[model samples]
Target: MPKDPANNICQTHIFEGIYNKYSKGLHDFLYYKYGVQTNPKDKTQEAFIKLWDNCKNVTLAKAKSFLFTVANNMVLNEIKHQKVVLNYQKKPQRTYTNETPEFLLEETQFLEKYKIALANLSEEQRVAFLLNKVEGKKHSDIAEQLGVTNKVVEYRIYTAFSKLKAELENFNIK
Candidate 1:
């Protein structure tokens, strides 16, 4: 049977109520997941607008999960778009000063090696590492945002760290 417009309105109202209660948390979740470069606020707003538009199709009990899933998809899309933009941009040559030749050379080499090590990580491991180490997200939160179990998140983070540490073993950063 076709649903009534009035019923849709009621569902939307309920979704809005749920959104009002959870928007801040959702925004924080996105920010932690994607970081500042991806513009979490705009993405969060867009996600909720999508939710409001599809409110009739989403049940109250499922609204939270739906909002998170929608928001994550938006973030992933933004990341992919940004990656394309970055790949097309011209690479600038870095110039080094001679005042501290030893320090500068070491720093440059370390950065190059670090980049290579990071590139070696799997996408999930890389994301987990950045979210935990750089963004300071708890394992539970990372798991929730990524739709994975906490144990899995922990394993990814550990694997990333192990790879980085192994790759960077020769570097004396101190």
Candidate 2:
């Protein structure tokens, strides 16, 4: 049965009338504003779908304005998304080195052994060594912080280095 055009557009006949009336105009507006690359025809269908979904709330009188507004906003969002994609494509991509798997395995093994060797050191030796080497502090500065003599700080760091070198000697660190 045919629905009255002045009544609610929730009726199929009235909704079809709205689609037939506005679909072409909305498509043309989107195409002229955003170009063919943005797919104006698809956006036109989507706007109609939105209108149909919200048919209960939208009056027949306001249907044309609703479709145009939805279609225009959809095209604008697509254009903004395309701009972001283009900007991402314009940025330089990072290049990776082609290190051998065997070399990487050896490096990983060396690091594990190094951590174990560091853990094996006496607390005094580990603290002094890390403060001197990792923290880049002088022997006198380490001695002042640890409340020890400069010579004692020097001895601990030397012992820690000797132990680490002996323990990590078997693994090839690349």
Candidate 3:
């Protein structure tokens, strides 16, 4: 079928039409590739946004390639950044067969301090961080529950790390 020339990437209605047509597939793609750690919906939106941004250059026929490429790139970016978001996920405690009693005592004390440090974070940051690390939620899922975008969730997680890093700068958890 010939694409409607009017439905170029620059046209809002056309762009939305493409979004409506492919959003689910794009989402499924992200979900399958990134699992629950990332948000496919956000990536889909980002891909569409990029299409629109370069609308004049994009055609309805070429839309699929453009969207997939953009979405894939976004997913790759997320995978690359996973390490930074993981600062919130530390081992609560690790036991050794020949550990010293003094080491155990100090470990317990450090955990308490860590908890206190977590408690001090802004609610938004704390929630996002914990949901990602403790609950093992994807930014996409957390964003849906909180009625925010995945990027917002990412920011919250990032800020949480910044705050925790500053607060717990002195201690090195083992």
Candidate 4:
């Protein structure tokens, strides 16, 4: 049927005619492509609203094309947004510790003092001490790495511990 040229889609009756003609097809298109989960009915209504908003730019001949295009794009955008939300939900949540501020400050201060104490050690003593304590090596293994006797390795480690104990005595470091 030939539409009246005088009454554009911006008019209530003409707009209603366009809605009646294309709303169902557009809704079905979105439903078939993305399913009911994507809210095809709402998207179809939104598309018609957009058409009305820009009715001056859209002709009766182009109204069907405009509705389908707008509805399809809206559904695709919503699907992409849902995927992002799902991916975010799947990520591992970060765990936060409930340490008090004073305790955290004390821990930080102790670490700083410990670093200074380690720095104060003689190179030979530091090497043997770290290889044994930090790296979990035995005195015999440390002696082999340092090309020294086990007794020498033991002496260096013992001196390192004694110095560290004295340096960190105020903090009660073991």
lDDT of 2 by residue, 83-137 (tens): 9999999999877668888999988987888888889999999999889888899
Evaluation by TM-score, superior candidate among 1 and 4: 4
| Candidate 3 per-residue lDDT over residues 1-95, each given as its tens digit | 55467765677787778889999998898899878677787888888888878888878788998899999988888777776667546635655
For candidate 2, give the lDDT of residue 112. 86
Model 2 TM-score on a 0 to 1 scale: 0.53
Q: Per-residue alpha-carbon lDDT of model 4 for 1-174, expressed as tens digits?
A: 544666588899989988888888888998999899989999999999999999888888888999888988998888899899999999998776789889999999989999999999999999998998888999889989989999999999899999998889563323
Q: Tell me each candidate's RMSD, in Å, in order.
A: 17.6, 14.0, 16.5, 17.4
Error of 3 at 40 (Å): 0.9
Residue 66 in candidate 4, Cα distance off native in Å: 0.6
Best by lDDT: 4
- TM-score per model over all chains: 0.45, 0.53, 0.45, 0.53
Residues 1-174 of candidate 1: C-alpha lDDT, one tens digit per residue: 555554452365765678688899989998887788878888788888887888777666677898889899988987898888898775765666656878878889988999999899999999999898879899999999999999999999888888898889663321
TM-score of 1: 0.45
Computed on alpha carbons, the lDDT of every model, listed in order, comes to: 0.82, 0.87, 0.83, 0.88
Off by over 4 Å in 4: 1-7, 101-174
